[model samples]
Target: MAGKSGRRSENRFIRYLILFTWALFCLMPILWFLSIGLRPRIEIITPQPIYWPSFSLDAWKMIWQDWPMAKYLFNSVAAIFGSVLIDLVLAIPAAYALSRFTFRGRDDIAFYILSTRMMAPAIVAIPIFFLFRNLGLLDTIYALMLVYAAINLSIVTWIIRSYMLDIPKELEDAARTDGAGDLRILWEIIIPAVLPGIITAAVIAMIFAINEFLFTLLIASTPNAYTMSVALANFTGGSDGVIYNAIALVSFIAMVPVFIVVLAIQKHLSRGLTMGAVKG
Candidate 1:
């Protein structure tokens, strides 16, 4: 009994140590960026680096004033929300159809939808760019939103379908026996049941839309439509050299929305992912 107890304690200690190490690995860069962003440019560039620098908001002010920070932020928010909305609207019905109904070529069609994700963005960017240009969607938030929605639709549908499949069909059958139409059953029963999965899908779709740089860079050429990612990249100086502190400040600002979203939906996210995995 004593030997078993000792081994359990050792395992607990090892587990905690591993978790702590992984946490540090993830947080180290964030801490470094926060430290740099808080300090002035001189302190950041000094040969003897100051581990803890005096907090200053000058970089934040400078970047806000010099860059179209507000516009970029607004554009990012608009695009992300728009894309997530579109993804959910389109994915939910498709997922439900795929999950509940039996139709010819259903599996093949589902596979084809998922297979679109296998193509790299770069491979399709030029053709998409020319198509958008021809359609006069270049340098528009709508264009970015549309592209992001299309890019994320496949994965979101698959995830929601998995969760939908986990829900017992008996529930739907009961609703049907009671004279609830298919739309009514979906709206009243299945939707609430799979709400967590939908939240998870929306959060993931938002994250992808927010971080997507390549498509945004290609689609949005002007400051009006450029997102935070593209705006951050624009900070790459030509002759003045990279502004480390400024870059860090803007990067931190860009991360704030995503951090808030993840924190808010973290519970639903875990439950949704677990349910989806177990059910499928």
Candidate 2:
């Protein structure tokens, strides 16, 4: 009995140590970015490698001074929020029909929509660029917003459809028997039940929109419509070459909103992701 108990204790300690080390491995880059962002640019490139150099705010100050950080931030915010709005508006009706109603070729339609995501973004980029240019919307915020919405709508539909399937059909039938219309039932019964899933979908869409680089860089004509990701890449390029400390600072600031949003909606996110694992 003593030998068995001793072995179990050692095993538990080893498991915890392994988990902690993995977490540290993931977080070390983020910590290094923060460290560099607070250090002077000269110390960052020191031959001896100054790990604990004296802290300074020079990098962050230079980043704000050299670029229109506020304009880029505003454009990114508009694109993400606008994309989420369009997605949610369209997804509700599409998911409802897919889950609750019987229609001709419904399954085929759903599969076709999902398959769009399988196509490589690179393949569509050139055509989309030409189309946007012809429409005279190049470098426009609305154009990027619409493109982001279309790109992310497939995942949103899939998620909401899964949640909608879990809602009881009897509830909708009960409302209909009481003379309730389709819109009334959808607003009162179906929507409330699937609110958690909707919130999760919106957050995921927002994150993808904010992180999108290739489309924004290709489609946007000027810095006025640029996103933070493009700005970060530009900071490290051109005749001036890379500025490691400034890049670190911008990267850190760019990541803060995503981190806060994920933390804020953690419970809803967990529920949405684990909706079908066990019978609810």
Candidate 3:
């Protein structure tokens, strides 16, 4: 018994050590960014890596005061939110129809939708730019919103459809037997059952939209439509070399929205990922 207890304790220690090591590895880059953002100009310019650096808020102050950080943040947040909203609005019904009802060319239609995403955005950017330009939507947040929504819609529908497929068909049959219509059953039964997947899909769409840089750069011809990613790029175009501290600060700030959003929805996110993973 003592030998078995000792072996179990050793195994637990090994498990914890592995987890700690992996977590540290994942966090090291963010920690490095934080250190760089807080360090003074001298410490940052030094070639040698400093183990411990003096801290200053000048980087943060410079970013907020000297740069149009607020405008960039607002544009980024609005575009992502709008895109996710549009994705959810369109995807939920489309996913339900694809998953629940049998129809002609259903699989073909789903594949066609996904195939749109398979084409590299770069290949189609010119035509899309021309279309939006003709519509006079160049350099607008709404244009970014529409572009991101179209980009994310296919994935969102597929994710929700997959989750809906996992649901037992008996629930729908029972609802039908109870005289509940399809829309009612969908709203009360299907949506509630797949809420986790919806949240997961929305979050994924938001992250993708936020990180999108190419289309944003092409569309944001002016500072008025600049996003966080574009603003960070603008910092590198300086004649006096790159501003390491400013770039670091912007990178860190860009992470804040995603971090806060994921943190706020951690329960749903973890459940969405894990709830069905260990099912019997």
Candidate 1 lDDT (Cα, 0 to 1): 0.90
For the record, the alpha-carbon RMSD of candidate 2 to the native fold, in angstroms, is 2.9
lDDT of the candidates, in the order given: 0.90, 0.88, 0.91
Between prediction 1 and prediction 3, the one with superior TM-score is 3
Predicted candidate 1 versus true structure: per-residue lDDT over 1-280, tens digit per residue: 9999999999999999999999999999888888898888889778985767888988888888888899999999899999999999999999999999999999998999999999988999999999999999999999999999999999999988888988998999999999999899989999999999999989889888888999999999899799998988876777757888988878888888888888988988888877766753
lDDT of 1 at 212: 95
On lDDT, the stronger of 1 and 3 is 3
**Residue pairs with backbone atoms closer than 3 Å in model 3 (clashes):** none
lDDT of 2 at 240: 70
Off-target runs (Cα >4 Å) in candidate 3 are 1-11, 275-280
Off by over 4 Å in 2: 1-25
TM-score of each: 0.90, 0.89, 0.94
lDDT of 2 by residue, 1-280 (tens): 9999999999999999999999999999999999988998888777896656898998888888888887887888888889989999999889998999998999999898899989999999999999999998999888889899999999899888888998889999999999999999989899888988898889889888888999999888788788788888877788877889889988888887778778998888888777755546
lDDT of 3 by residue, 47-105 (tens): 99888899899889999998889999999999999999999999999999999889999
After TM-score superposition, what is the CA distance of residue 59 in candidate 1 from its true location, in Å? 0.9
